[model samples]
Target chain A: MSSTLRSFGAIPAQRLVRTLLLAMMALLAACGQSSEQVDDMVDFSPPSEGVSSAEKQPPASTGNALQVDVGGALAAAPALPPAASLDEVAEAANRTEPEPLSITIPGLDLNQVPVIASGVTATGEMEVPSPLEVGWYRYGPTPGEPGSAVLAGHIASEGVDGAFRYLERLKPGDQLSVAFNDGSVTNFVVDEVVDYAKSALPFDELFARSGTSQLALITCGGDFDAQARSYEDNLVVVASVVA
Target chain B: MKKFVSVFLGALLSVAFFVVPSSAQSDDARIHLIHGIPGVNVDVIVDGNVVFENFAFKDTQDLSSFAGQTLAGLKVNAAGTDTTAIDAGDVALPASGNYTVFAHLDADGAPALAVFENDTSTVAAGNGRLVVRHAAAAPAVDVKANGAVAFTNLANGQEAAADLAVGTISAEVVPTGADDPVVIGPADLPITEGNSLIVYATGSLDDGLEVITESIADLGPNPTVVNTGDSPIDAGVPVGAGLALVATALIGAGMIRRSQGITVDA
Candidate 1:
């Protein structure tokens, strides 16, 4: 064994092969640690300061005069018998369902793409819509509602390009609109585009319900892992409501 | 505690005209007012003004804008009449929280009031919260989800809660330890993700027992990951296979060199 080792050491070709093996092992180690390092650098910062400042605006009505007159009325009024039922009043007060129809991103050349209400799958991940459609996160606020509403789409599926294939191309100041079933359209301007590793996604900030009204468009990006058959990073584009 | 109902009403009357202190808190409290008293139409007065007129059974009003303010002289009167039925005086709404205030009946069939602070905490991903409140004039009961008792012996004026997966559940309320007479429903209730579905068992059991619901949304947790694509259309390179192939080639080359060296020595 010692003579074989001496012969192997004496050969320059064997020495070059050993150096190449060491380099390959180092490369493998770096690949394994890259995702963790990215996760450590993940920022959980809240929304922009300008958005939070708008929430401090004063309310329109104070109701001061009405507050003073409430005491005297209760003492003056006598107890009366229950009146006849009016079932119509209850029907008029029922809650209305949101009817989001389609999304339009002219910058991405996506025109009036249909949207469907999507929920989480059995494994707790957001269910992606079909290649040609966008999915609105029905559990969150609607597109025009006052919260962080999320919309997800496929970048590509089965070698075909999906609805959000050009989602990462969205830049700040870019415009988009979401049309509702009621014939109304809500416009939004792009705020920012971010790319996050799948393991380092800021769940709290991305899914927050209380904040300035905003919309999030998401798709897969970064390097593809063939063994896993998925992308390593998520591309997110955030847009604020246009006043 | 036999005078629980009157004592609670008296507390409201004493504080009906008191002023609320101003605070710098900016939390928004979402409040929903539900009229659960069956067979009666009423006008809901808040701070001396009739906010809801001719409010019938199961009628709901969003009082979220009134959060952080004192509802002085809050009263319910027979429709279009000055006769007061239930006066919840000077009720101070919380600065931040989801709440539901119901004008319901107690266990003894007397008209009463209930203020339920809803659970608005973050729900697990793909799951929702279900809250059951007994605001009816009835005995203790068992609340069932899909024909199985999820909450047992839930008495009037009490509540039970659970976090369930997002789906539709067939809900029914029955007497404790018995399933023959299903009281409330075999109704289909959709348990949506990141939202709380609060179901109130209201009215008199013998008169017209029914269920009213309020949904508080945006309580769902962010998904751990969003895998949108099954194939890589734009993913620049298939890095995993590339790295593995390079590593395999390097290892195989080294083995061939070592074997050649050993053969030369032999």
Candidate 2:
């Protein structure tokens, strides 16, 4: 065993100890580094869950209503067949026109930044547009719709500042606007700014299609990996429709 | 042996520090209630409690909160009277996914209840899902999208569905093997991406057939990763610095091996 170790150029015992210490430090630095910013005003529940049963209750009913006879009704109504299995058909050819054309954030001094619809890449990562433009997640809701619409932009690329470079500086109550193809504009108010580790982002909540209308502006933040050329965290700015 | 112990400890520590996020989707079922029986104002009672009074045709309600719960003595009575129209005893809502319950006429034109589960699966980008359900008191019909037969021979109480690119398509419903005498409209239907647009052939054919729609949204793939930036511009500590530290540690390990009289390869 010693001969084999020698042929492999055995590391000195002190140097091995130092290497182990450095690895430990690196591991420690990467642990429990949560940056989520909690906002009390935002209701994260889906729309269905938000409604109460009492709201569906009819106006005070007369106590004279008698118990319904189920036997006769059941005899008259035939039992429905089991749910049918859906058949796969050929794909349809028609496509919808993209709605959102541009976005504006007055507080950030971003005026009418061009927006483009984008989809996921082959690897399942969101395909980001150029630093000069913002990418709207095409599969999600459009801005001002009854769901969360996601828009992602770059903070910086290759030492150049991106369209969302100052996204972290946005505060609650900041105004933002989105213009659609129909020449209509929807205004929004920033609800909160949160920073999350990329691995820990709540994808369901960020892309939910129920509940109040929302817009999520996303960009890169936190530690940058030089080798991977990526950021370790994402900064999200959530905004709600101005109604 | 000491070196092996230290290396093992380092590996164990790294493993202990790794974090994995949970990716479980919510298990809450989305339920919608629709009134398809025309010419009658009714009171909807679930579990012997009147949930909707004076409910007219085309009135819809979201019953999502009742997911996973069974309602006993589900009854629809004439408005302001005790006359029972349809009684569905002990209806159990699904624990998850999307569903719609309709009060419509069966093929025999009798008041009946039909429960259809809506597909909530993620749609491909740039596409939308369309579901055609036959709930009217009509015979088997062919559903046309953009004047093409998309769903054929769809009988009462059955459903057919497909995914199509997001756009507007002219929809029409006609009797099987006949294009003339349309039972329903050639109305323009908008197919929005990430949503399942369910069109129901509702109301009795003799009483005037109609079409009602329900949309289930948010069925889209979440991006596996969002890499919005390149370069370490915002990083407090560059990853290269950490790599450098790791490289230095490896070099130290090499030095220690040399001190232990391990032969250095030429």
C-alpha lDDT of residue B181 in model 2 = 84
- Candidate 2 lDDT, tens digit per residue, A120-216? 7646698888776789987777888878899999887756567788889999998888877666777889999999999888787877766778899
> Taking the tens digit of each residue's C-alpha lDDT, what string does model 1 give over B170-210?
88899999995988778767777677777778888788787
**Once model 1 is optimally superposed onto the true structure by TM-score, how far is the C-alpha of residue A115 displaced, in angstroms?**
7.5
- Per residue, candidate 1 scores C-alpha lDDT tens digits across A27-92 of 222122234322321211112442233234344222343334433433333332222122221232
Q: For each model, chain A TM-score?
A: 0.62, 0.62
Model 1 error, position A133 (Å): 8.3
